[model samples]
Target: MLNLSDIFAPSNQISNIEVNKESAKINHSLNVNVSVDCVVIGFDDKELNVLLIKRLQAGDEKAYSPYKLPGSPIYMDESLDDAAKRVLVDCTGLKYVSLEQFRAYGEIDRLRRAEDVQWLERTHGLASTPERIVSISYIAFVRQKKFRQLTETYQATWMPVSKLDDIDLAFDHRQIITDAIRKIRRDVEVQPSIVFEILPRKFTMLQLRAVYETIHGEKLDIRNFHKKMTNLKYIVQLDELEKDVPHRAAHLYKFDRVVYKRLRGSI
Candidate 1:
């Protein structure tokens, strides 16, 4: 027969054990959780564009507000690149896009919420608090015509990249877009493959020059730009020319896949 004090003391010990277990969990959550977001860039009407989707709130079936970059949580089993591809395709009906992971944003308190603890609890269903969220951002170049707005619930639209500052976005998407734009500009200088994303299947040298100038935000010397392209030797002269132009018809050119692949490695 145990004394009352001993029985009560054991109950107290069990309570302490449970408390310790919970504390351990809270302490162990120091690692930042990973997520993925994509910056889908396209070129249309001689301007750079980005894909955006309006965010929807829980239980607000009819409430859609503020455009944001298409993104989602990374699954445990999927690779970051795979997760990005999945999210882009699932959200926008685009596939086989050339994507590159640009950077990770792991700033604490990046997410804004009305009720901090309650928001996490309701959204993620975590038993304890999450320490940090690290989002991996990717940039992909897609043709404007390739994307189809698949989900009506979340309105997806392509806005010109130059007008990004004019719109409001959720989370750190604005920063992500800025970074992606910088990356695109850098690639334009070194990798000629990026031109394929903006130019039509068959384009004139002047049109290609226009793409470079548009992305660089500066005018390129027509002769020098043409000379550089000729040196690269990847553009094939097509037996076609622009029609109904006020000026002389410029010779149209197509990107040679074999030469592009060889130059891709060099770039």
Candidate 2:
């Protein structure tokens, strides 16, 4: 468990504090409740995936496990960016993530789902809540190698993006993820893809193409892709090949981020 004293206040300062709700309201006049949600995407060899957490069903101990995106209400003094990072770390044991604010969801009943309302009430001791919840959603990409390290300390599991259609996610996360991926696709078209976030520092052209195809859900013509990549001039070929593959080894290449940023600016 996270120590609230360590995160919110020093023990010496808060040792005998007995601030009630009325006193807290008088001390800090802010009344809005906000949260941060993360759609953490990663790529492995063959597919694009999102990380989800397993939660116990409210009032049901032995029922099928319910899954949801990792998130939490923002702390009183936390920045939205820091709240996103804190939620990710508290839920998934992931830290130092590269997160971008992709969208804000503030529908009057974003928490209208029975499970959502019930879970919040049960977990947080809320009753007859009437205020709307505003969630600042963020998107982050993790390289497969880095993801492996995070999974060691987390119970979250990665599910393929393609399979989300059959999964029942809590809250409006399905829509959140849909919007996030749409933005990513648009960015991929014009900007240097942050897809490199899910790739290694060095990899083959085929590996690079695989990442794009998996996320875009389309097959790129091999000849056209190779031609376009070469023409881009930002992908640098390294004088190295795969070490132990049974098939013919493909030459390795790495994206020159400096060149990509420069070309993107000109475009």
Candidate 3:
């Protein structure tokens, strides 16, 4: 019923409000409590180890006994992988390490335990501990040489995985490591490259067997182990022998990458 002039009048016009670009870009409902946890596995001197970092308390300069898995909250501008790599560098001073996501844990009580809350309070300076944490856990196999690059001190200790039960790890890390172990065990049976990471590029059969036994957590029959390895086409036995050793000079061997690629699909 209104006239065209009245409808188009400046007095009746609705103006568009100017919005602050930064304020308009904010996402309040986005999950910012997401974090990444790394279960770093390494082998040295015929023993398998897991990397655990000692977190210094925020208030007390002297309290630094409690060890926890290397982790950090995902940053606003970084991808999850970048956040994980940052955590790895922060903990081990190593970069470009291979990592694969193993699990995503989202529980209301993931960070609600009393010990977890206390540790978060003392170490992280969190005014209020997050009630729920959604963490993406990753597993990495660190070569012995790469592991040696880490400056081992009270701050960053490489404890034998077998002895993890004796040590009290912070947060739900113990369970996460347990899950990673199970996954690695399954992976090693299928992928020979995993075992290679724990040993030198050129290693004796005895050294290889020791690595396997350490990861398997049980003694393997030497004869059966040899027989199974001999049947594998990818394991190339070299004419080269050990040098400058206290023990006998055993023949060395290495896995052939070309053969492994061809056989990987079948395995």
**Alpha-carbon RMSD, each predicted model:** 10.1, 6.5, 11.0
- Give the lowest summed-lDDT range of ten residues in model 2: 8-17
Tens-digit per-residue lDDT, 7-126, candidate 3: 323332211212244664432121236889888888774877888887765465554337788886664445788778877877766677788888988867777567667665444434
The parts of candidate 2 lying over 4 Å away from their true place are 1-32, 58-65, 150-154
Per-residue lDDT value at 165 in model 2: 92
Worst 10 residues of 1 by lDDT: 10-19
What would the per-residue lDDT of candidate 1 be over residues 1-267, giving only the tens digit for each residue? 423223223222221011244545232111115768889888763777898877555675443226788776564445789879977876666677888888998888666543433433343434443456688999887667666545554577888887877777767788888888888888876876878756788888888887787788788998998988767778888789988999999898888878778767663
Query: Per-residue error at 39 for model 3, in Å?
Result: 1.0
Per-residue lDDT of 222 in model 3:
95
TM-scores, each model vs. reference: 0.71, 0.81, 0.81
lDDT tens digits, residues 57-89, model 2? 545864332677887766555589987887788
Give the TM-score comparing model 3 with the true structure, all chains together. 0.81
Over 4 Å off in model 3, which ranges? Answer: 1-32, 58-65, 151-154, 264-267
Report the candidate with higher lDDT, 1 versus 3: 3
